[model samples]
Target chain A: MTAETQVREPLTLKRVGRFVADNPLIPLVVLLLLLVGVLEFMRPGIVNERWIGNTIKFAIPLAMLAACQTMTMLTGGIDLSAAVAATISAFVMATQVPIVGVPLAICIGLLPAILMGLVNGFGVAVCRVHPLIMTLGTGLIATGCLQVYQRFVIASGSVVPDGLAWLGTGRTWGLPNSLLLFVPMAVLIIWAQRRTGFGRLLYALGSNETASRISGVRPWQVFLALYALSGLIAGVTGLLYVGLIKAPSLSLVNPLLLPSVAAAVIGGTSIFGGRGGYGGTILGALILTVLGTLLTLLQMPEGARRILFGLIILTVTTIYIRLTEQSR
Target chain B: MSRLITKHGWTAGLLSILVLLFILTRMIQPEFGASGLDSLSRATLPFAFATAAMAVVVIAGGIDLSVASMMAVAGVTAAVLMDGAGDGMTVVAVIVVLLIGLAMGAINGALIVLTRVPDIVVTLAMLYVWEGVALLILNAPGGAATPWLRQLIVGPFLVPWLPKSFVFLVVCVALIWVPLKRSKLGLSIYAIGSDELAAYRSGVAVGRTRIAAYAVCGLFAALGGLTLTLSTGNGEPIPGPYLMASVSAVVLGGVVLGGGKGAILGPIIAVIILRLVRMDLTLMSVDPNVTTIVEGTIMVVVVMFGGVIAYRGRQK
Candidate 1:
């Protein structure tokens, strides 16, 4: 009986280690739980159902935006213009709602984003321009166009459509209504990453562009489609965010740009490309949202808060990198 | 002449473009003369220095997203230290501010080396850290620059037509950049940037060279900050639109983004050209908002052109 007991204990320990090594998401989930525990301990009863719902509501838009980063980072590129595209879509949609009906306005609003994405794709894939510079240039152009457009539409009042507001802020069965849109989107992305030919193509191109080209991958077509899809996602994110905020401004989604990149990076996506998934990115979004709440509860000044935020991101990323490297 | 052009074709072409733009600008604003040049030089110095800072790092195969934030920190620090100080004290303050800039850059290098983090991630994090420090030092933008320092930096030199700022720029290029470019360390920088593995195999100190490159970048960024304070006569905790502008300038000046193949003179010229274009837009009474569109368009076009040239070269 004693020999059997010792053997069983070692087997259980080995199984746990193997489980952790196989699932990278396990550590992130544990970290998330730990953070929530700390938050609950600090302020009793703050982690209620309503608070959970609110956090999920805010995290949805971020996760949507981070989707752009995840997909682009998969191809070893980044879309700096995602925030700009989102802003343009939301601003255009809101203003056009007054002049035009909701359905038409939404279509018209999404046009600019898709067009910008096409241009980015052309520059990166055809012209062989670096993704960073291409996106940066396009972003600045989009911002300028938005400003010019703003001047023309200043006289027309803007309003959020009722349907969007419901989708953005409504709830059902203790879950955010955003989940209605987010769940399908997240499922599509995860499925595409794993099961689709295009998904495998993205990974192949990111991991080794030259080899992919040699294998007749037709990279230009892939890049063009990829960027356009990214733009669409960004536009949708903007619509969701505007509805959530209930106000649309020229710089509506600008601040989310860096955070979205951070989310992707924290999700264990390599900036160098070809490694990561959207599931990790969703978790990353939730973690950042919770961390932000914790910082706000600290009641620090803006300067101190920023400093602490930067330091924490740096430390967390460093530690996470070390752990993953060792496990591998 | 053909040999010279072959050797300095980019410089020659850029100079011609500069001259053409200068003529166009002079035509639009008839008042653009020597004094106009003086003001232009003053306005260009801060950005020129900023572009130089970015150029140095890019040439070394690293990008510093924190340069603008570094400028802000240096500007506010100098403003806080030099406010209401005597000439002697202001001189000391200037030196100290420059040193602080150097130190900030060195720390960025050290952190990247020690942490084994990518340059972009480390610098991106430091960007916020330095910006927060700037805000902490001066919550609002209201510090004054010493009159003597301001005059020395922004005012004209011995000749009325020759702005002190222009002279300072020339002196910096000749003293700092040229010497470094000629030195063993500078060669090592280029070697490592072009191929780090090969450079390391050939006995180059990659880490130290990179650290030195960042340190130089920081010094120039501080100079830019100082120029900003002198011209504005106040300290600004917030960074201006220098980051994108400097990056564009560096790229426009023909520096390769992936590093190892560019000159400092190119970015300096690019900055001037960009500044000239902005002035031209203002003179033509175009909407200020449209200026950004034009700038973006120009950047895209130039990069596309460069890409085409490189593609053709590769095919050959």
Candidate 2:
């Protein structure tokens, strides 16, 4: 009986591997290419240098945020608080920018985001609280702090120094600075996930936390470090969000939470944890950006747009899970 | 006392806040003395019922974030069916509303079991879908909540002074709370959440138990929604979305996430305490947003602190 089972397992694995190899990124990449083709074809002048630059530019942060979120999720847990954490840090940093100087403010601004991430990590890793509840708890607290900050301090007519906002809005060779920063970060993350001990440990932990522990990996430390990375990435995104939008609105952070998860999941990262790459997340982000752009161009109502958004997320995720399952 | 505190965290916390709110209101508002308590009792009845419904699922270890949406859908369904059918059809409407809630629960449970999607994701997705479907039905709120609809929930019972909704809430607790604790279904729910495979190996029907839990969550959420429509006499898309926090309230009442240890009474007291806290803040001249901050912070601190306390107790 055991020999028969063993004989069948490899054959199943080979078929799964062949299926993935043939179809990976085909649907997502095809859709993205098709959108680009249609837009460029229909409005060659409008999809010109400036438009192309901006499209890629906005795609940068969306991609980076998705990538950062994917790293944490790779460990069989999610950081729902990422968007809010970014917002709080951004508001804090932006508020302090004029008073303390942009450089100093950036360092200080990064603190709150990192600290909250650590608290989140401690609750989940050390205390054994479920990640969803732990993060959800802190997410609300951070969001409340952002509200208080907005109402009392930031809304007290504080202005982020003109030069600082320029980092978000300014162009380097007609490309956004935020987008420029997103590039190196993405490359570094991809390398780390593929090669580094810490990176591999995250996947191992996510794949099976108990087995990883038994293999002598420190699960808590991995969780803490991963959360810190999540915090750092969110801090960067927060700064960029403020720079692009000019004013700090609570809604800016509120909506990003689900999309980031969707981006991660759609990018082929398993919501069940482990076995995914950031390449897929970049495509997912691009898909979302294109969808948003299309909806706006199409003049869809808010309700219809929301319905489409929810449906697409649900559909794509279900398909991804099914495909991955069959491959296994 | 420690045993009492642990078992009744929501209750003890709630009563203490109510007492504090009472004293403060008397010292300042003065007119808010006895009448204030009566107003509060009636005003908080629906939320208590909603929270009780929320607890049923929390005990079983799943989330029904779509409950508020389901409630809105069911309320609109009830109102539209009985609209101008008048006072005579109130009993029938109530029964139909309940049946609709049960049906919504059943569908949600079946989908979760079949798809194997995470409950949070499935329910979160359904939140929008159901609300969208509800909007498609009415697209506006115009129906009167009918006098009979109001009386069924709001009218006096044995005490003559007590709200019928409060009585209904208590009756639900009595019917569900004790038997659930003793039943095979309830115990198996805890087992499933604690560890799915072990429960299955132990001969518990994990899938059915979990599906039932989700179904029950949907039903409770529907009840809460219907009660809300009766209380307010309106059904708007806006209220349904904001009610997601009701689930959060249940968690604050000592229902651990990832499920297994909680009581209906815990959530019952939690909703009441939370309402009292908001009311107390209004008296104190704090902005209403302060309530959101306080509630959010309390949920985090209490749950975290609860873990620490439970850990300490185990060590002892």
Candidate 3:
């Protein structure tokens, strides 16, 4: 890794610069502020309480998906299989609800995601496979199996079952029901990292797997748990999306994968692993969602939208990397 | 020499896998013997080229998610440019697409080095950029590659029985792979991939070698695109299944994803194995999805098997 050098600056100036750079989420907050302010300016009253609520509603699934990315990245790996897992989970939930009922169907749907995550973990940890190919293969497997499932079992329809709508799109006291889910999940994730031994173990595993292995850390077990959590979170996101869209498709969550990774990275989590938190990812998710709305409001085409997203991810991640990387 | 051969445990393993797949293919599809082999090779050509393209970047300790997009850009660019060109424009069109690929790869490499960003971050962005660019250049994919250009990939110059796909692989191994592997720069590439700090300390031109690797990868990607265009006689924007497919094949071939290990022959053979697997699946009247499932399983298994190998290798 290269540590960029800059010319000397006065004491206070340097301190502020360093502070802004050190916190990955700080820049994101600035960006989020600027975006909301602009949106309000462009369309009067667009940035009201309702707007915030809607933004959060739109943001819930992305935040949940990004949370999965953060967990995987914390271990110095990634789960490219995330979107596929979420899609499969959603597909299952959609197809099974008629036969098994909503509750049982949801449980059954999440099982495949767990299995996929377990395979990814095994491949990365025990098989010593690189995470990129390992997760990608698992993703391919998930997609393939889903297609077969669709063909042989039941054809999934566009409409999400009525029973599934409440958790995804239900409102409570002017707040989205998904917000209820997001808050606890976010709190639990943050608590797990800050309070639990497993969280520390995850960071340690990413910090130096060989050292961790020698130190009796059982890297594989950690990987297994971390990845399983990733899958579970992805499953939750899939279910939420089905409720939000009212229609479940294999690609329902595909677009979310990149943004989720971007959101986590924008929040300051290192792709190399173990040095960031959920706070940054949450902000990152909000920024991405707001940016997305901004783009749609501007009527940018799909090509341009992708270009902007790509650029934002590149620029933000690099700045975060360069800034914090130098100090660490 | 024997020690050297043994050192490439992964490559030897891949070769055996290839042989096993070949025998199975021969046994299962006896009609696919001499006569049917040409079409099989033809169908596998684009992916085979793509796997090789991706292997180069993976070996350099970087990843390029934009492989298929680059191919798409190359294909569509060629078709769009040569659609109704005047005399001798075909050669110009080929060169242009190839250069476009090199430029795209260079951007990926440059961003990675200059920004000090992780390769995945940079390349991930580039994937979108290239795909977006492909969309911009040819929004709906409605162009035809030049007639002679399509023939060139198959090489009317070669023996009638031999597909241009196999011929291209042979040419690359002989011309590019063999020489590059033994060159001083190759050692530098391996060194940089294994440990950048150590490689830099050892006086390797890490940045340049990394850039060169992407350039060659870009070249191969362009070749892949041209091959696709030639095979289909038309261009398509969404040509990324090959990128994922290549990643799967690379893992199957046992090429260490972060570079510094594995032989060129590995992915080349692994591509064949995957195509054979797909062939077998199709012949059995299995849904196309099953092929993807089996490919994914094979990749998972190979990756898992690799973990054991690495563990035992570490102990030794």
Candidate 4:
């Protein structure tokens, strides 16, 4: 009976390992649940319906922004200018709402993001500049342009549109209103990733650019479209974030840039490209949001918080890589 | 002579550009007096060192995003140690700071090696870690340098135009960089950067070379920190605008982004050119914000031109 029990234990362990290898999301979901349990344990009844709603509300904009990173990183590139684009959209839309009303102001605000996207695309596709440097340059230029624009619009005064405010902060049946927007967006992104030709092309290019080019893929067009789409996503996120905060500043969404990249990376998206999905990124964003809550509850100093954040990211990524590598 | 010109064409082009920019600045502000030169040297010193530090790592085929943070850590630490200390103590403090920098860099290299993660990921994590350490050490902007130490580092050596900072830079380049360039380790660095597998197969100590490269980078970053301390007579925990500027300088100097090709002098000259351009814009009374736009535009244009050149070469 003891020998039989020992054999069954090893078999069960092996089966569990195989299950984890096949489903990467299982571990992340487990981690997320564990974090929630920890939070509940710490504060005793802190993890209620309202807490869940609030967490989702905050995680929505971050997930949207990380969507940009997930897509770009799929093609072995990144949009360093995403935060700048988001900030510009939010700042411009807020200021313009008082002058031209909501619809026109929103359209105008999105224009700059698309413009930056095209410029990034042109640099990467046409000029063949490295994506990192290209995005960095454009981000800087956008920030500078925003500052210059601020000098002119300082007198206009900014206002948050009421509709956006409702969408950003309102709740229904214990669920975040932002879900109305994010759910459709997330579904479309996930669907397009698996079922669309462009999505396949992104993976193909990333896995082997030369091979794809030789096989008749137009590298330039894919880059241009991908970056433009990333820009549009960033713009939308900016608008939502402005609504969430109900305030607009020159640096309004800038702080999210690194965190968005971290989210994409933690979601199992490879920085080297061609091995991740928006689904993982969504989970990553939620995990980060919960982690942030935990940190705030701990009431640690800013320095300690930052160090712990970095350390956790490093540890989690190492473990994730090890697990995924074993599957391969 | 022709071969020399062909081999060092980029260097010549960079130098000529530097000269032209200098002449243009001189034309704008005709006074361009000895004090003006002294100020230019002082302003360029920290960035020049920072750029050199970056160039070393880039040439070795790695990027250290935490370099600015390292400068911050070293700068603040030195400030805390050397504040109101005697000359002898101040000197000892400087050495200690440099050693700390080296140790920090070695740790970075080891982390990357041990984790088996990409350099960018490890360095990115380290960037946050080191920045947090800097914040912990000095939450606010306040640390002093003794007047005597400041003079020895930043004051004019013998002439008004040739500040001790410039002399110190030259001495560092001569004593440190030149030796490294001619040494076997230098060859190994170039080899590893160009092709790591090949280098390893050929008996180069790839891991050790990478660690040494990072260590050297750390030392230079520390030197940059010390320069900042001396120039301001106070250490600010903030790394300020040097991070992107140093990277731009490295690229503008002609180092390939993927690594394995470039000269340190080119980046030094590029740093000077960048500073000159800023001075020129200020002299022209352009909105200070416009400088950021111009800097970004310049980076794109220069890289585009390099791309065209490389494409042409490839075709040939």
In order, what are the TM-scores of chain A for the candidates?
0.94, 0.87, 0.92, 0.95
Writing each residue's lDDT as its tens digit, candidate 4 over B67-175 gives 8888888888888888878889888999999999889888888877777777777777777787777788888877888787677666577876677877888897667
Looking at model 4, give its docking quality level.
medium
**Model 1 misplaced regions, further than 4 Å:** A1-21, B1-3
lDDT of each: 0.88, 0.72, 0.81, 0.88
Mark the regions of model 3 whose C-alpha exceeds 4 Å error after superposition: A1-13, A155-159, A326-328, B4-9, B154-158, B172-174
Model 3 share of native interface contacts: 0.75
Which pairs clash in model 3? A127-B307
Model 1 interface DockQ: 0.65
Number of backbone collisions per candidate, in order?
0, 0, 1, 0
The model with the greater TM-score, 2 or 3, is 3
- The digit string of per-residue lDDT tens for model 1 on B131-165 reads 88889888899788998777776667887778888
Which residue pairs overlap in candidate 2's backbone?
A: none
Docking quality tier of model 2: acceptable
DockQ values of all predictions: 0.65, 0.39, 0.69, 0.70
i-RMS, each model, one decimal: 1.0, 2.7, 1.5, 1.0
lDDT of 2 by residue, A1-328 (tens): 9999999997777676557645657667976788777766655655666776677766666776776678877887888778877888778877776677778888888898898889888877777666776777787777767776667664345456566477667777877776667778888888999999988998899899889999999888888888888878888888787777788666665667767777777788876677787888888888877766765665655556656766666676666566556655
lDDT of 3 by residue, A1-328 (tens): 1232334344445565578766656777888899899888888888877778889998989888998888888888888889888998888988887777777888999999998888887777777777877888889888988988887555544346675588777787878888878899999999999889988888888888888889999887888888888988898889888888887776889988877887888888888996788888999899989988887888766677767768877997887676665543
Candidate 3: how close is chain B to the reference, as a TM-score?
Answer: 0.92
Give each model a TM-score.
0.95, 0.83, 0.94, 0.96
Candidate order by lDDT, highest to lowest? Answer: 1, 4, 3, 2
